[model samples]
Target: MDAGCVTAAHRVSCHTMNADLFKPTPERGPHQSSGTAKNARNKPEQSKPELAQVVTDSRTGRSYSKGKLLGKGGFARCYEMTDLSSNKMYAVKVIPQSRVSKPHQREKITNEIELHRTLAHKHVVKFSHYFEDQENIYIFLELCSRKSLAHIWKARHTLTEPEVRYYLRQIISGLKYLHNRGILHRDLKLGNFFINENMDLRLGDFGLAAKLETVEQRKKTICGTPNYLAPEVLNRQGHGTESDVWSLGCVMYTLMCGSPPFETLDLKETYKCIKEVRYNLPSSLSPAAQKLISGILQKNPSDRLTLDQILNHEFFKGFTPDKLPPSSCVMVPELHPPSPAKKFFSKMAKSLFGKKKSKVEKIPCEEKEDRDISKLVSGIVKCSINRQISYKTVGPSEVTSPTGQLVSSVPLEPTPAEEESRKSISRSFKGTMASGTEPCEDVLTPAAVAETAMKVLKDCLTAMPAANRNPPCLSRPQSFLWVTKWVDYSNKYGFGYQLSNQNIGVLFNEGTHLSLCDQRQTVHYCLTNNKHFTFAANSLPEQLRSQKQIVELMANYMEQNLMEGGDLHCEEQASALPPLLLQWVKTDHALVMLFNNGTLQVNFYTDHTKIIVCKSSDDSYLLTYISRERVSYTYLLSMLKEMGCTSELRHRLGYVVQLLQHHTDA
Candidate 1:
């Protein structure tokens, strides 16, 4: 085909040209003839009516069956093809023989294939075999089912900072490999960044790629997508590794801001913007992101950040996940880092116990007592108490009931210090008590509390009828303890929750619990079910600072991003010791948490519904249900057991029971 009568096949061979190749005469560059540009625009390119179902290799005698079209670019059409004998899948790029008729065009294709086949890197697309027949040239490649970043960008207009870091890191790795090999990609855009099924990024599309040359020897070709072209390339200064860096900056900008930095209505205007190194930095971008973009998009190629320098930039220091979920391609991903508390505790454990059990055993008794205080606080050792005798044997014949009321029990006398400690604990419990109830004369151990709560829940679940319909909404007091807002950062840190009373708590992954209470002025930390320490938030020990920062971060995130789960309200207790989360279990459908204060809560994932069972200050079991509509209803647990609940609540209760049973059994 002649230049003026270029067909789709011919266009494929010259795929490195600008996007304006099909534009009308007036928009053509001054170097192009008007008549030729008009003829190229007027001629509609042709494509084969249908891809051949079976294609055979000329020499190897291997046959392949083409499945579906993967994508089409200016150079070739990619399809899913499987070798009939081996049944191995491959992403095969098919170029019609007619496309590479010209000697130079054929040479370009040959150069791409040779260069790509020699590359072997984790981040670069794996090149397979290539063969040609009379009809077309087929180059087989590793199948990347996830398509490319272009599709992801189209689906999600913008990506999170962490996500941008994740993709950029891989891109840089691949770019560094090519640069180390004295190669310049020349073209770097979203469409060239392929994603595999594993969510790994594979740099592909080397149509405009070239070997690096000294400044004087470099070819001054205006090739590459217009929006991504570096100013030096447009000015005929020649393509270099820096040109690729400039394009990378553009890719980053596009991923974060949802559009190329130098893009404009007209092609010439875009070139003007690139030449001037001009683009708007949206205020919405993070400071690190803004700084990185500015550093990479320098007017002078040498001034731009190098691959290593870009990787070390502050923008990359953020939480880039080890791997991304496939769902992230179409939507925002829910990413949670390991909790700071978990990390802190782990470090402390390693320092105290060493890595081996032999080392732990070798520790001197005195030193162990001094350094292993965390073990005491972790609540692994339990003081076994018989359920029947727990309430029967006490200092007084009267025992505190679940409702904080005095109940008949065996009586005994208490020492003055014991009485004083009891009074202190009673005062702390007063904040969550119902009106007219008296504080228990004794403190219940965390284990006892958990056991009691579990038993109550188990009984309630067993007695409650199956859910065939919605549960009846009972009108009762609205005041109850429930999670108003929560965030799962369990992947890194832990699960965080904000109580209706404004107490923020995190059940860390390491089984430790930290809570911000007294309007966040006081910090309550629990190492075990019963052992805990209370501190003035500002006076936290140096070792606990990291955990504190993480909790604060989760609190701030939830406060700003999450909506309240229900309308249930409880007055903030500025002096109360918040309940400690003893154990938390996460299943596919829900998160179940058991508190040391005899409270059981289950939050459903499918719907923002919640079930909270806690004792009322009036000595009765209270069940609070938060509906998906952010409305709450409180009912007596006994009443629900007798009247039965709706299927929605019933199903959740069943799941909670199973979780509790598993926890107990384990």
Candidate 2:
């Protein structure tokens, strides 16, 4: 009987093995049918289909009958799910409990959501909804039918000007919108820029935006892409929107130069180069482009050109959208919480450029290195004119040799007509102030006034010899002549620069000096040594806008540039000059002061000697011209080779200079 039971158990085990492999079923055994039934009942019934069903978003009253996995990242897992209610498709990012269970992680995600929910702009990606499920969190975002900038770069190898410009303008616009609202998108890079199917670019992943109560407070954090990070950010003294501007500059430089301006195989070296702040822009870049780069990359944040300033730059002239694109066209991205990536770079940048401990006290002014800057200034004053010691053939018979001799067979002497002209010119100007009501602002002491009058008289008397001379004589009207040129330091706006070495366009009226008082209403003595100009407003009902204050700011900036020994060494060989004319121009909220006096202006602007190639693929083209402001010169240059300006206005402005005439006449 025991053997019979054992045989029956063996037969039952064989049946169980077969059933487990294929399908579970009841099988008849010789004598242990009752035992098999008891074993099956004790084990338990199979699970019901409903028990193994996947959970749906029932809280949102949304259901997805068919869902599939899409992608995964460090933060979340994305899935392609269908909404059964609307029969619409959606991409859902599911964050697992393991990821956001920590307080810090949850806080970051929440911050990101809060930022994305409110921060809306055309070039930023949009976030729709956020919620939590049993085991994971869900963030629904708009599906973008486009590729990342990296993908585009990989596919296209590089970008064309049009493509680069389009994306840059979009990015700038988005950043402007953010900055205007007092937010800083801390993470910016080419990878953050996404291009859609329509080839329109959108800024994505605003996980690092920091909102500040004040404009100055915006730069409290040190965060950004390594390659695109600014030096100030690395130093961590405090950063502002200027950081973003720096990144934008890097992007632009990459667009033009095929890589980031400070690039190396090693990350540390790359950052070191950035801190060193040295770059070699291709020589073929336009002056406008160079000006843009210089302004954006300035070490001082306040000195760096603002968004409005950059938009008006001449480099962007070719790409500014004809019609202003709406702000809503771009996607609004969710804020990304602080992550390991952010922490890693922030720490690296800090350690690299952080302030080093010093055991020595700073040197006092007396102990500081003596540069004798005044000596340099004197050099500038002396070398202000073209007084070349060597002489070449200037005109046919007007040859004055090195020996100071008349090589011709004639002894040159003033004619009777010249003598009479000289006598009349000597007595021309009295140089004394006309009798008038002495205003409190321009009041001069009797002795001081007399001294000034005497000096004026001396100047007029000294100049009589040159003014009285007839044409063809070497002597001519020798007014304290100088030319000042205007350059666009920031082109995103229409801000013009007043560089003394270049030519600004002709002005309608030149300004005169006026005595300005201070807040005390005290009549202070004139102190010209400091170059301080006090403004006495004739009319005022309100305070000044920062842009209006830019006038004084620019003057101070120019003074600083001058005091620091500005970038005039390259042009030191040419004649230096001061402004013959001063203009105080106000347009809307912007004001510009023009001083037209300098040799650079005469050579490049007035004479049209410089050839500015607006676009260039290489540096060879950039070496062609100097920076000068002459509206007419730029206009005439475009059509010069076709319509010969010399033949057209042959008698009007006289000959257009032999060298320039050759270029235009060609």
Candidate 3:
């Protein structure tokens, strides 16, 4: 195999050089004669198979008709061939198995063939046919008119935001299909990505793909571009489908920002950067784009966003390349490099005389109010800390600095102001901490304790457990005062809320913001004094997110149970409220109504002879009678006003009103 061939096989060492490899003729050097120079300049690039003269059609075993080569690798040569049989041009890849002596080479080729054979997706490169001739094996594929994404990246310098969205979506769609079928394209990089004539993407070369039924079954073999490899892969640890997601994220950064995130001339330095998980988002990209990238680049595979999540991102909304601005006028960060997008190559320099002086310094700490308060209360408590350094042999060693001396020190006492701050921190961190331990730490300094406490508070606020947290439902709980007073005067209530309705210009708006399946989707609801109310459809419960559907479903089910021969009670305002259980009402949808204790409920017109039970303690559950036909936003708003709803209810209704305004204006 040629040294230039980038093989995806896990065991195929890219480090080996084949002795039989062909090198560019020396006569074409820059100092050569004018004729030689012209020939050298015109000499076809090794990667461009379309420029190579056809020797023979390996598939037919007959003298080849005229066509050009499109791509080439070590053991194989691919040409854009005009099939004499059907007069159609197709890409034919020719590889001689005997010439490929690299370990796992056959396995790589077989994997590619098998993966292509079983998978059928619009965005993936299609395998049309395969067979062997006397001298080589031939695998025919669909012809791609445009160059590799690498070539496009070089030519355009950097892709615009819209172009990034347009291409990434096509690739992710193909990947989603592959993942759904239990396959992982272990090697996903810009070089293997093809752009078709229609400006659509075609994922190419599945040589390193694996069939993964379980997370443990995923690959641990290291085979990917150094710049794009995930941290887990570089550390020689096992990796899964999430590794591809990380690589794809690198590809996305390249497309949108014009360079792989972790890039430097120093190989070890680059590796260290990746290992430490360092990447910066330029201000040129939108916050949403940064957030999506951050989610994809999460270090823990379990936390990374899947391909489907990328498709649903708001960043790709209305993306199209036909609308791209001129190349010279393209907006990009000033830090982006000049292109022919250079590969990550080694340029280590040997110092002739001596090493340069080091200027590294310790990271300085800045003192701020919230930070100080947090540190004072939270700093070293609950955190694993050893006061003294010990030079022990085999048993155990105490924490120490490089100087090898005991480093025990007395913890400072907090100032009166910081002590007051500690009181609040104790309340915040107490919930999630193991039972029985207080925030008491003897050694922490006043400022340090305050800062630590703030940190603990921040962690608590960010990682609140679902059961203990009051989740933001599709809408805020209708004010208890508003509901009680309104329900007393009216026997019949009627109103409808549209799903994701966001066009009106109203003061009240209600909805749920949830993170599900590593993606974010919103659900909405509109409640009014008229007992008539409508909820937006339900959505799936995603990780670390509030699902309105689950809330509504639990509410409705409980309401039905109460109406059915179940118990019911409207306890005193201060009494313990009923526990809310969120049920799955529908995919991408859910219902919310009153549920007393464990019983369920269903709300409907009484003409059908079905009893309706209402539970007052279940604030989590609210009843809504959905109209058979989707209700318009304007009518819903008018109903709310007619019901003489309070200002608080009106505030929750603002979101629906905004939706109405958006549509009417549109």
State each model's CA lDDT, in order. Answer: 0.69, 0.41, 0.43
lDDT of 2 by residue, 297-341 (tens): 776777888888887877676543322222212322122335768
lDDT of 1: 0.69
Comparison by lDDT, 2 against 3, better one: 3
Give all TM-scores, in the order shown: 0.48, 0.38, 0.40
Model 1 weakest 10-residue run by lDDT: 1-10
Q: Which tens-of-lDDT digit does each residue in 38-107 have in candidate 1? A: 1323455566545565678868777775655676655467877766445467899888888889999799
Candidate 2 residues lying further than 4 Å off, grouped into runs, are 1-55, 64-74, 77-93, 213-221, 319-666
Candidate 2 least-lDDT 10 residues:
1-10
Better of 1 and 2 by TM-score: 1
Number of backbone-clashing residue pairs for each candidate, in the order shown:
17, 31, 81
* Best candidate (score: lDDT): 1
Prediction 2 TM-score vs. true = 0.38
